[model samples]
Target: MIPAQFDYVAPGTVADAVAALIDGGEDAKVLAGGQSLIPVLRLRLSYPSLLVDLRKIDELRGVREDGAELVIGAMTRHADVISDPLVRQHAALLAEAAATVADPAVRHRGTFGGSLAHADPAGDLPAVAVALGAQLVAEGPGGRRSIAAADFFQDYLQTALAPDEVLVEVRLPKLQGRWGVAYEKFSRTAQAWAIVGVAAAVRRDNGAIAEARIGLTNMGSTPVRAGAVEAALAGASAEAGTIAEAAAHAADGTHAPSDLSGGSDYREHLARVLTRRAVTTAAGL
Candidate 1:
């Protein structure tokens, strides 16, 4: 289906983009890679009167390091993310997850901010973002504000972005210690959205888990941290038995949906199973 007619403006700077967004008001929508928004437009799920294209905003591209943080511009493509040597070495979980985002074609055009802003429960980027304790930087006419990953996602398909703001970049803290990270996804076929996905980071000290962060995808309305598992993994063995015991609470406090791909109970089971496997893989067990 064809999309509703809309005025288009390509902003040259972040300030211009925010001004356009505010001027366009609620009837305007920001355009990133267009991989997600274009479909919504074509399906008439969104009918914004104006489209603010962010492709030319130079400030919204590339990656840089600031002290202990790795700042990734919102417009950075998933493909770039996966291949970036810096990201691979320091933020391997993100690189791994991006490599699995709907194959190469989609990743080539989809922006990291677009995926996270879209807030799709099954989207790989958001899960990785949450797991890494990333921070989103949003700029508006009012000024810039930094939002933590835990506070950015509000509900299914909902985020905390204000109408006049544009997400500029995501800030991730540098991985510390002898950390092992893994991204595990379960899909029916290549390019299929994950039925269940897990992103795990484990820090080992003397072969014992010093710290762990696990994020579950497609297991809730928003990507959720496996706190129970993290708590259980602390001071515990990184062996299979212990991992399984902690991962038992993987589905706790999640509002996972049942769909044709799987049912509620099935998703819960997957959450547990995948979390265990991902943590194990990260531990190199």
Candidate 2:
């Protein structure tokens, strides 16, 4: 299917991109890697008056270190993200989750920021971002500001980004010490969206779990933090039984959706099961 005609502009700078978006008004759409938006356009689901492409914005396409945090450009490809030394060293959960995003070809073209900005609850990265307590940076006509990953996603296919703002980068605190991370996902196929996914990051102290962060994918309208599970695992024994017990609370505050993939009950079950696996692995038990 052919998309409705739309004017397109490739901006070399974020300032220019912002200007273009503002000039295009409410009908403007930002094109990153086009991994998700292109299909919507082709199906006529979105009829934008203009497309502000950011491919030429070189600043938004790399990984760098800033004090205790790692800064990732919004336009960094999934492949680059998975292989970047800074990402692997500081935020292994991100690389682990990015490795599971579709196939090699899609990963090569999908932008890290694009996936998060797309705000699909089923996407793998948002869960990891939430689990890592990452910060999303956006620039607009007003100025630049940071949005917590927990607040960045609002609902299904929705985000906190203003219409005139462009996501510039993401900041992740470096995980130091005895930290183990894992991302466990249940999908019908390698390229299919997750029916349920769990991102776990555990920090072990001595023989106990000192801290644990758990994020649930497709468990609600947005990526949900497994607060119940995290609380249950705090200072708990880093053993399989203890982890499994905490995993039982995986669905405590979630509102899982029922779809063709599976029923809500089934997803909740998967969440518990996968959370146990992810936490156990992360705890090194």
Highest lDDT: which candidate? 2
- Show the lowest summed lDDT stretch of 10 residues, model 1: 81-90
Question: What is the RMSD of candidate 1?
Answer: 0.9
Per-residue lDDT of model 2, residues 1-285, tens digit only: 999999999999999999999999999999999989998999999999999999999999999999999999999999999999989899999999999998999898999999999999999999999999999999999999999999999999999999999999999989988899999999998789999999999999999999999999999999999999999999998888899899999999799999999999999999999999999999988
Encode model 1's per-residue lDDT on 89-123: one tens digit a residue. Answer: 78999998998999788888999999999999999
Question: How high a TM-score does candidate 2 get?
Answer: 0.99
Please list all clashing residue pairs in model 1, or write none if there are none: none
> What local distance difference test score does each model get?
0.91, 0.96
- Work out the TM-score per prediction: 0.98, 0.99
Query: Highest TM-score among the candidates is held by which one?
Result: 2
